[model samples]
Target: MPSAASSEAPSEASTAPWDVHRLPRADGKTFLVTGGNAGIGYFVAEQLAGTGATVVLGSRDADKADAAATSIRSRVPDARVRHIRLDLADLASLKASAEALRSDRLDAVVHNAGVKFDQPDRRETGDGHEAMFGINHLGHFALTHWLAPLLAAAPEGRVVTTGSFAATSERLDLDDLESTRDYRPDRTYGRSKLAQMLFGFELDRRLRTGGSTVRSVVTHPGGALDSLTPPRPPLHAPTTGERLRGLPAGILVQGKEAAAWPAVRAVLDPSVTGGQLWAPRIFGLRGPPGSGPSAVIWRTRRSRPACGRRAAT
Candidate 1:
């Protein structure tokens, strides 16, 4: 167990009142961030801990999660953060992770863990579902179901599912949810993300119908690259092509810290309501976070060019 501590003292060099450096205080709150060991997830945990939230990092790798917690403590000296092993690719692991949550009342959960397909070969989980859909959708489905009770008990609870713009172009095939017959790596990933967004929208509807206070929303960390993210354990130093790609993209893409803003807002901001989609301000890419149309909105609005044609609306 990691030692508990109060929030870190704010910095004196703060620029704007609404800057990521100056979030509204979250003292005494408790939240969980899945895939909290790396990329956007790591920064989300760090930011939440800075505001006085007890952050539980749900990760498949215990050592990596511990390292992330240590890094947060190093940056925010008094930050309260801990790690619990959680493998989202496996259903049994999700159940165990939910059961092991130490907090009696969880204020929020940020579902951020996922695979960025870099290979052409298809993969599947032990349960025989496609790896991307299994981890990104079904795994989270079970985890959220298990934790919904705890969330409902809190005065205000939230579930933030991280989605992608790719979802807008991909249609989910209920008849072939696993993408078994035809699996193109990138398209399958898009389908999985779309499924996640669908789940978020559906969850909000169900919560509203059931008169539950637990809100569900979706967010996308646009153009967040591994090159801009801080190093994690077992670092595979960027390849030559990746380094070349990073140099040009660094100008256009937001760093992991900046990309984390939308997710952070989804988890903590009071103004953000259920079923909203928060995204980056510039080109939905690199800038401060802001509210965007939800997937439900995209489904309904055909006037928008990007959403004019729909295979899965």
Candidate 2:
């Protein structure tokens, strides 16, 4: 396991307030962040841990989870954090995580784990679905479905799903949720992101329609600079000896930590609104959190413009 993640000791040069701590009420809250083992998920878990929140870092590897928890705890001496093993690629694991979490009412959940699309290859999941859509959308959908009861137990509990301006695609094929038909990395990703966004908005509508009020919000990492969308697979089929070509303008814009922020804030910040989006500034490079409309418009099955939050810095 990676040694307990080292705490990011605040630099004296940082613009954040010094000696002013803002910890959430952890007394009754139990939160979970999928893919909390590394990248932005780790730091988001870390910052939440700093507040002594009962944060659970959901990961596929138990060792990684332990390492992440240890590392996060090191940063916040009083952190009350732990781990839970979950693999988005497997439906059973998703069910297990949900079942385990059901034992403890989930005060909040962050559906932040995702995979970037690579050049076309036979990427399949246990349930026979394409890798990108399967892991990114279906698995998350199942997990959310499993945990809905737990979230609802908390009345005002929140569900924050990581979305992207990349979702601003112009079209979607509800008929082809698996991308069995025509596939392009950009449009595929955009479709998934669009699905997540619409899902977020639709979830809210469903809840309201059902007369149950749990806030379901979505966020966009405006540019690729911050969210740290993983790079594409090698262009070649075998991916051998090939340098793999580059990406479009905004594809690889943001850092993973920056991408994780919107989800983090969505869960921790009391101000987060259902169906609303948040992100960093720097044209998606990376920055502190701020609020605004998302650059991407949520379409039933397609999208329009891009949108997101700005940096407080």
Top candidate by TM-score: 1
Give one clash count per candidate, in the order shown. 0, 20
Q: Write the per-residue lDDT of candidate 2 for residues 1-313, one digit (tens) a residue.
A: 0112122221223223222135454555778888887766776676667665688888888887887777766667878787777888898777788876645478788887888867766478887888777888877888998888888888578888887767655446655676776677777777777777677777877887898768887765444332134422121122222212322434435444455665666777765667555566444334555555455544433222235433221
Over 4 Å off in model 1, which ranges?
A: 1-17, 230-247, 295-313
Q: What C-alpha RMSD separates each model from the true structure? A: 8.9, 11.4
Q: Estimate the TM-score for candidate 1.
A: 0.84
For each candidate, what TM-score against the reference? 0.84, 0.75
CA lDDT of each candidate? Answer: 0.79, 0.65
Candidate 1, position 22, lDDT: 82
lDDT score at residue 276, model 1, on the 0-100 scale: 69
